[model samples]
Target: MRPTKGKLLGILAATFVGQMALQVGVIQDYWKKNYWSGQGFAESLSPDQTLLQLFGFREFLAGILWVRADSFFDEGNYDAVLPIIRLCTILDPKQIDIYATGMWHIAYNFTDEEQRSDRRYIPSALALGKEGSRQNPNTYELFFETGWIWYHKIDDDYHQSIKWFRQAQERVDMLPARRNLLANAYQRNNQVKEGLEHYWKLYAETAEQYEKQKDIYQLFQQKETLEQNLDTMIVRMVQRGWLAQERGEAGQRVYDTTEPFDVGFSARVIVDEPKVLRVQGTWNVLPVGTRIRIIVRDADNPNFTLAAMDWDGQNEVVLDPERDATFMQDQGFVKNRRFNKRIDMSKDPTMYPFARKSENYLVEFYYNPRSASLHVQDKFGWNGEGMTDKNFLRTDVRKEFEWIPGPKAGMFTEDWKLAERPTPPARIVYTALTLSRDQILRKGDWIDKTPMVQTSNFDASRFSVTTEDIIDVPTLRSSAPSPIAPGEVKKTGDNP
Candidate 1:
């Protein structure tokens, strides 16, 4: 009870030091190394953890509040955003934005990405609005914000966005047409038919969510007059005979060691056949903002694989295009992998290549190179590194096609596109030239002209080709590249 002043002071200092030590290693700093690890802590951390930290349940989380706050804002989880702010102010009362907006509008109505711009925060937002209104009641934004979230960001009741807006001195009036919003989402997704259907549904449901609908019924009915116009004006791509089947030309050629090849063959290989292209590149137009990956490797070179891919909207897509090699900052994952990799990270934005694909793409990276491996992979879709599938050169084209190890699993199909006669049903074909580097180097030196025979996974008894169509394919041979003089090329040492 009778403690000396010096003793009391010492105890206080110790407590302060202890608090700092524990805080230094908090969740915020725990991921300083993973700043750019593509996946951030928030991605895995339960929203509750973020909320507790945001509310100041833990002192160490302060460092990452801004980012965490932004993350919450981006998610438009208004229900959670407000509570966290209330807790935050208890710890740091003067945090202006936290107090001012913690729940102001759910984004105009906050959403997974967009702010419920029209909606305002619940109790807290209302409290602030009340306070703000007293000081500047003439301004309407504060009052309207409350309703914005209720109308749009929540279950999507635009009626509320309008209601609150009306209470304000000035209103945005027209945010987005209720029906048009759905239409826009569909159109943006390239689902025109679906979008049109929804647009009509909206028209039928409400002329305008906020406006009158007496005249809407008459106008919407007129759409029936343009029924024929609903049909797409785009031309159809039609082929005849074998062109319609996978008889050797169904899938896009990843590569073919055949010269104007037929559908089937003995073994899928190049026995001194210079006429056959070693590998062909069949590209896929990747969507924007989505992750993607592609891998091609030798049968023997299992340590690593050489892959080329397109990202619909990563760093590569943002950077200006170049004539030489475009820098691909983003790397995607393979869906299937036998091993697991441990990764450490930091707090920066992880970057990768992202290019919007307007249509089918074609980017050939390697040639009739050698090794013992033959695989193709794309994993961005999966949470893992990526997906991979093993392919082969076969001697039988009529057997059965086995599903490769990864995505789109099925039976293997030998001589998929190089076989003759019996055409398979395919919209496109995928082929790869399976040859060793040593074998290709001896293209004309020690090669044989006899076509190799192979077996296929196809079972005619299983109903030849299914009702489902297959991707069209082609047999392509690589063109010889002109020799480049080494001396003419500049080197790092040459610059010096």
Candidate 2:
């Protein structure tokens, strides 16, 4: 078995080549499974051609195209840059910034060039973003970009925006900016509960991140500021009845649903003057032929109904002192008339004598279907003592009215204020405790001395309240009474 030197050398070379081949095969398999999963590889490229075979060069090509696209963007050649960006995506679909920039250019920059009127650009950007997300399904940034385009560029459709943003939110790599955007979208769309939930989530996440940092003084200051902001948001939401607490509830209820049935009762005081108190809003999603009553009353004398009329849910109702004759024969008696009257408060001295007096008034809107009922009452007051004549009384009384939804519809009430003051509930305390824990020791030694938390998280589904929760929270109440002249009293009470 004594071989020659050349034969032995050949044998050794063959064994080394075989080992190298095996190692190469193992590496290729790993790359295929991990790096190139769900991605197309150029089959024609040779294994030995490292530059063409690797993913890095594709990224480099994309970068080059990105620079070129930027130049085209600077030149205001939006359409021209799109094709270049498209090619870049093909070269490296996983590049998140490429998709974000391309979508932004089409959605915002290009649309701005056309004064936001061209609807074509929005869909184009959305399509590009979706394609990018399709190629890189694991990335959150691409999904966030799609949501941003839908929210800001498209027709302000928060529903569609939230759909994509939620997808981004599900990813663990979600940024604070993305979370803030999602919260803003929810709030804008009147999904207050969901918005508050996300805000609290953000607050917790931020606190957790801050605790991990080494700086002590900066952390304390930041923590204080963040806690204050969260408290303010909680108070505002509770005061507005966006989040309400019930006696048996585990947590406050979030008015998160957007169904018209959920928003069935809404009203605004369009005009509040001495002569007339006009209220206008919608009673959406009520059953067909539902009876809605519009009632105006003197705030001083709640018993006296200034004006009352019944309306079917088919059309909008407008109650004006000047236009009542169209529906009435005498002052208070409503004749069998079907006049479609519009709301206009023109100066007609003979028609609206109540408009001349400077006093407080109450407008109530009552919705009572056989199955469901709702009431929204508003109070508006005026100080007319200083004004010499009724003509001098200001007619521009555009006070905002507080529209409270009924308890049967799952709306919250003023009870949240009481639940939060002096001591916040267990849920809020839990949040503070969790956030205050030190990252190193995982201990909350300073928890007891922590500032009283203003917000809490309760199980909204556990809320069970009776009709008693439906309290009449007045919009405006005057402490002083205005002295009325003898002649003015008759005019204010008399029918139009």
List the pairs of residues colliding in candidate 2: 251-458, 251-459, 274-354, 274-355, 275-354, 275-355
* Ten contiguous residues minimizing lDDT sum, candidate 2: 425-434
Local distance difference test scores for all models: 0.30, 0.42
Clashes of 2: 6
| TM-score, cand. 2 | 0.40
Which window of ten consecutive residues has the lowest lDDT sum in model 1?
334-343
Best by lDDT: 2
- TM-score quality measure for candidate 1: 0.21
